[model samples]
Target: MADFTGASTGGVSTIVTDHAALISACAAGEKQALKTLMKAEGGRMLGVARRMLRRSDLAEDAVQDALVLVWRRAHQFDASRGSAKGWLYTILRNRCLTMLRQEDREVATEADQIEATSQEAVLTAAFDGLETTTGLRQCLERLDGATRQAILSSYVLGHSHGEIAGRLDAPLGTIKARVRRGLLKLRECLS
Candidate 1:
């Protein structure tokens, strides 16, 4: 264990060294090596998984399964072929992609549908409850339909900017700008 703390310093060489040492130790059946690797990169790995899988539970499962594979296949890593960090992310990404493909085939159960409907109802109600005469409502009404829809789809409907962009058939950057400017306008109006 060569000071895992050095790995967090954001230097490329230090990260490579730490990951290489950890992976080598893992290949040698050192259980602590896997723990150290997880401690060092688990958050980033989970972030990547979450971005790919969307669902937190599924992202967690993907990260766990990727770690298991890393333990089993550590011996296959070749520093000459690529950096240790890249190798590790490659394994994690592969696991996430596999899980995503499997998820595509999964059908929503009745309970899942009910839960989603209730959640949507709650979100919709929050938006609907805004009194017509309130400053917020009046400010929202002042926005153009596209901008207003972008803001509501994100804040009220719980959609990702990317999802809203796709739904509106607009560029992602445009959708983001609409939301940002829309909020700024609302803030100015309320003030």
Candidate 2:
């Protein structure tokens, strides 16, 4: 229950206290100890969650879930093995990763599929509608096939340079260079 100020938190002085004792109090169903723990570490916890989750809303959700878990599992915390702060962050990180995994596993609905297909069709039509004899199309055709494909994948197909590199089985740097050099050549040809 002793409190002192310290600079351990990235130059920000926060009241230093025994997190283990706070957790113990929480384990004993002391609500005030939990509030004190949150007051001391909530911002840091949120920051950790935000970095892991990326999206603010998702980070908030993860932190909220972590805090709830901490409340429920306080009795299980073993201070001899690790610090309470480390325990808190582990929970937050696990929650964030779980959310990310769940998002990856989500099945796209029929509406989502149709929307994606329509968007892809629009981009494809725009690229295909370019007349073969037109100056732009001629310039694109003049480039090496790999370079032209790289530029088209990035600009018209809306793929990232990394994605284009993966698709072409080329290095990321090579894909980026192709797109840059192709654009420069096209500008010179157009001008």
Candidate 3:
């Protein structure tokens, strides 16, 4: 999806694969292999970016940028770290996180938004009237499964820290950390 015509003679080839033989062909300077890899994985990349950005247009652009990185830095794909899938996901996810952080930095939050919710009891009450909470739920799914559940119990369900700890049967400190970190992340995302 990214145009590399300005790069060089490397722009002229058509290697098509339903997967990434990119780690192989890329080292050989086969730009077409990169194209093959992108065509195969770009849709999924867009989907991930879409989930993060929640905008089709931004998702498309993010995928375009991600693909450009994939193409240009194809050599960085290391099989030992994992498959092409993991590597690609890491890059796109990082881009999405960076974008989220940038959005936070670039757009000033209203005084109300900047006001941190004071009590655990108020979280559910605050969100109860919000239709956008479903979107918030979806965004929370981006966390690891345990972290996601811990967060839902605390915020969306308004469980007290002790209650969440009891329900999860996790250490109190662990649950607290997860809740603190998860809320911070959700605030970043929902912002």
Candidate 4:
């Protein structure tokens, strides 16, 4: 395997040439090609994953997963589309994004549970005609109809932005703004 350490010092062309050859060698199943490629690019790939995940362990796992994906999918790489380096980074990015989205779902689930519990308490108080509930109802009533509906759909019905947008026949951005503004107004009113 050729050493690519000096390629960066040599020039952009040298780096590109080396990366293309390394990718081709890996695709051809050259025994040491994948190992050589990792040696050349692993640290940079890990850095990219670390920045995306913000956790050392998760970043390491993502990089390891991305490497396995690269090895398995080497044959699918098309040099005609772009540089080999870009292709490798694309794989790493996809892995990182997948992990980030999965983490978001887990966090959202926990948050939703907490929100549900709080909402139940609020509803119970409102039904009991508590003074706080009267104040909250007045605040909610002061919001414009569209904004109020958007807020209710999100907090009460647990509808996602897209779902609320679809139900309201409004743009997703519009729904998001309405919900945000509605919450701010409610905060101001309660304060």
Candidate 5:
């Protein structure tokens, strides 16, 4: 079936030197340099924050704040210790670390190895904590059988639409429709 979302990711390339020129230009008070730097490194910084905070908007905000700080402090930059790219990375890292520390104060408990060691167990415990009937399972139960199965396969089993279709012996379009309908039904039920 067609994936109209146009979502595809791959071919990771790690470059430590991409931001050096932009940093140098920014340090020289070139506004164009700062703009170039933002365009060049924004995606990477966003990825870093997202991985650290597990939240998209917060990650974007963190990167934006870091870029602002970098622009304001560019004059004090020292090239002897590290490259400009490294300096930008340090700024983003510090911002994410600080945000994480502040967020830690509000959370009741930390979730360190819980995701790595016993993810299913953690999810089960969290789900069971819902004293109300609006838990994930109950909401899922309200969906059509095929749709619920498709959604469960994609979300819980971590399968793609094609994989779910293959496993369930259904057409890919059918699987995608089921998954979408299932998710909408679940959201409505929970709401």
Candidate 6:
């Protein structure tokens, strides 16, 4: 066995040396080589997946899928364009992104159903139960017209700062500043 550990200095680099040989061994149906590759790279791959998915179970799933892919498609890995480590990570990243896109679609479909409840309806229900509405109204009244409008567009109408800027014919920075200042004033008044 060639010294799999190369002279590179980093943690990943230490394990990633001679990836081509490991991948070739996998391609040649060497199960121990595949196991060696997994032993070396699994933790880092899981970390990458966890960062991307933000959930342990999802990260594990992605890493498992990526390993299965590495097993089946080991013969397809081309060493000319990039390192074998890069190829492995590309597969893992793609799997994570695909899972995320699927999750986003599921959430979007669910959100479509929930969107029938207007923000105003929700706010009205909340304010109806709270005695702080009077204080909030008074604080809002103290704001300058532009700042108040910015806050209202953001909090009441659910507009993004960019959208508020477009609607108010102001720069994005100005809109952000107005909203920040307005919130600070409201906070001071409420406290």
TM-score of each: 0.51, 0.49, 0.49, 0.49, 0.47, 0.49
Best by lDDT: 1
Better of 2 and 3 by TM-score: 3
Model 2 lDDT vs. the true structure? 0.71
Backbone clashes, candidate 6: 0
Q: Write the per-residue lDDT of candidate 1 for residues 1-191, one digit (tens) a residue.
A: 23456544545545334788889999999999999899888887887676556567988998899999999999999989999999998898888766654564344233234455464454456557799889988898898877876776554433568767876899999888888998999999999
Predicted model with the maximum TM-score: 1
Which tens-of-lDDT digit does each residue in 118-158 have in candidate 6? 54354344335346558977787788877876776454333
Who is ahead in lDDT, 1 or 5? 1
Worst 10 residues of 3 by lDDT: 105-114
- C-alpha-based local distance difference test score of model 1: 0.75
What range of 10 consecutive residues in model 6 has the weakest lDDT sum? Answer: 118-127
Model 5, span 1-191: residue lDDT tens: 11122223576443433456566667777887676677667786787676555567778989989988898888778878788778888888788767765765334134333233453443344445546565676886567666765665443333468756875798999778778777787788778
lDDT of 2 at 184: 98
Between candidates 3 and 5, the one scoring higher on TM-score is: 3
Cα error, candidate 5, residue 105 (Å): 4.3
Clashing pairs in model 6? none
Q: 51-76 in candidate 2: lDDT tens per residue?
A: 43445787788878987888899999
Clashes of 1: 0
Q: After superposition, how far is residue 102 of candidate 1 from its true place, in Å?
A: 1.1
CA lDDT of every candidate: 0.75, 0.71, 0.62, 0.71, 0.65, 0.73
By the lDDT metric, which is better: model 5 or model 6?
6
Candidate achieving higher lDDT, 4 or 5: 4
